[model samples]
Target: MSQIPKIPRRIVTGIKNGRSVITDDAIATNVSEHFPGLIISDIWATSQMPADLSTEIIVENTAFPVVPANGSYFRYVSIPPDKDLGIKPLEAGQVHPLMHKTATLDYIIILSGEIYMILDEEETLLKAGDIVIQRGTNHAWSNRSDTHCIQLAVLLAAN
Candidate 1:
């Protein structure tokens, strides 16, 4: 299997003594492997709407909730090729093992490589620079290419 690339650096800015300053600038560390070769890096989060900027942003290293109640989540995901993970192509009238739903509105941007967005009854190929506004739905991502597919996603809690 090919190696997954490192997560990108995160730069955060905030007010310091009434002047804007770079508060955090470093490679993101809240990374986890959900599957054999699938990686997710939780970059940041907010616990409420009209987020309080006065408070320090503390990114927790614990397992993140799928959809934070009345909050938002920002993360990057790296999906390895399905073949490398021993996942075979779906047969007709089949459902992927990873097909699931979340109570969040997801904004996804493909950062590199390509992947297939598998819907309940259809699928579409997404490549670098492609964007997806995924409402709460049952879906899955399948990477059939030879390399990893990296994507940046922001999930907002939905009613």
Candidate 2:
């Protein structure tokens, strides 16, 4: 199961003041250089999304869409509150596999707990702030910690 981080929301300025809007193109370069070992502030999304939606808290009850045209946005489909992900215990000697998605770019971040990402048949441990870039690759999340492993997921769509 994953718990979304509670991020403070910020008021967007450009759209109201007739100032130049920060378009997606301006940030495309940043995105390419942003993931994979990127350690961005928790305020990252707060600048773009409303305070209510800014939280990293992901629950199955909420499903939002991200429009990548003018820019990029994140949406989450939270896991059901009462149900558990039934995360299997990740042993040191274990190798796990997950299904692959061909059309999307997925960025996974480990939050409060640790997990092993089984990517392309290789196992890697990911702790807080570690990022995994997955593109058309098969992967799985294996939790080794006794506590529930929480993760943040961001999807960047083609503009």
Candidate 3:
């Protein structure tokens, strides 16, 4: 078996031609383990889900009610249709705004495909399994890949 590689987290984009890119994807890494391509839906359970327990998600307008499933862990799913696909030709470091449930901490995770997360002037790349804790911050998920970017969010309720 090939060893898993490590990539430093930062703002990087447009390295599609680089072989090192496939290694950067935390999702693609798992996909390469046994299955080929991005058909690894089997790894998106509550236990395997990325993000913190205090999270909530609303995708394409589909609202996933908050669930407290563990001592300090939880996640939510906002299916497509509610998420407004942003403008085309998404730049390398542009922050797209996403609406979140009023009064909550949202932890975003990608279920499938690649999603570029923009928070302010910082943009981070997330693949399946990669998690980001959005603590009352403005953000958006952009699908630069040629596939649908399914995502799961864990939102911490704001008191």
Candidate 4:
């Protein structure tokens, strides 16, 4: 099992009566776990409605939505390394079958280590600093190495 990193506390500062003060400082989120090494954390989300600064946090416990509702704000996700990505038989280029699709557009960035972005029958090897813009498609992430691969994925509502 991969040891997920500690999520930083979100601190919201504000001005009160001409004085700056921290209005909210706490760990806020709604997390979803997929399988053993896969995780999705919803840092914060907003709807199409007008902004509400007074709202501290909006909790979401639903599975990754097939399609984000209209006017919904984007969702940020932190992807930890796949500790079991390298568990394969002694065969070359033997990738696992962990493919799925989503309706929202996703922007994924490789923060550390290398990973394979598999789509349909094709795969692309990506390393640190690499980026992938996933537009409502089927795909999966494979870390074929022993080290963990950290990634940041931002999902936005699709038309």
- Give the residue spans of candidate 2 off by over 4 A: 1-14, 19-84, 87-98
**Per-prediction backbone clash count:** 0, 9, 15, 0
lDDT per residue for candidate 3 within 43-99, as digits (tens), equals 122322344433222222213233334212233232222132334554565434342
Ranking by TM-score: 1, 4, 2, 3
Over 1-159, each residue of candidate 2 has an lDDT whose tens digit, in order, gives 434333223333334366566322322111211212212222123223234332333222212223333233342211211123444454566544233443446676665666666665577877777877766466665555544445566664532
Off by over 4 Å in 1: 56-65
Each model's TM-score, in the order given? 0.92, 0.45, 0.43, 0.69
* Deviation in Å, model 1, residue 8 alpha carbon: 2.1
lDDT of 1 by residue, 29-95 (tens): 7887777778888888887887777654455543334655888888888999998778999889888
**Least well predicted 10-residue stretch by lDDT in candidate 1:** 56-65
Residue runs of model 3 more than 4 Å from their true location after superposition: 1-86, 90-102
Q: Would you list the C-alpha lDDT of every candidate in the order shown? A: 0.85, 0.42, 0.42, 0.63
Q: How accurate is candidate 3 locally (lDDT)?
A: 0.42
lDDT of 4 by residue, 1-159 (tens): 456555535677778998889987887556665555555556555554454555544646444553346424334344444555334532456545566787777788887778888886788999989999899878877766666676766666676
Model 4 TM-score, all chains together:
0.69
Provide the RMSD of all predictions against the true structure, rounded to 1 decimal.
1.9, 11.2, 15.0, 3.9
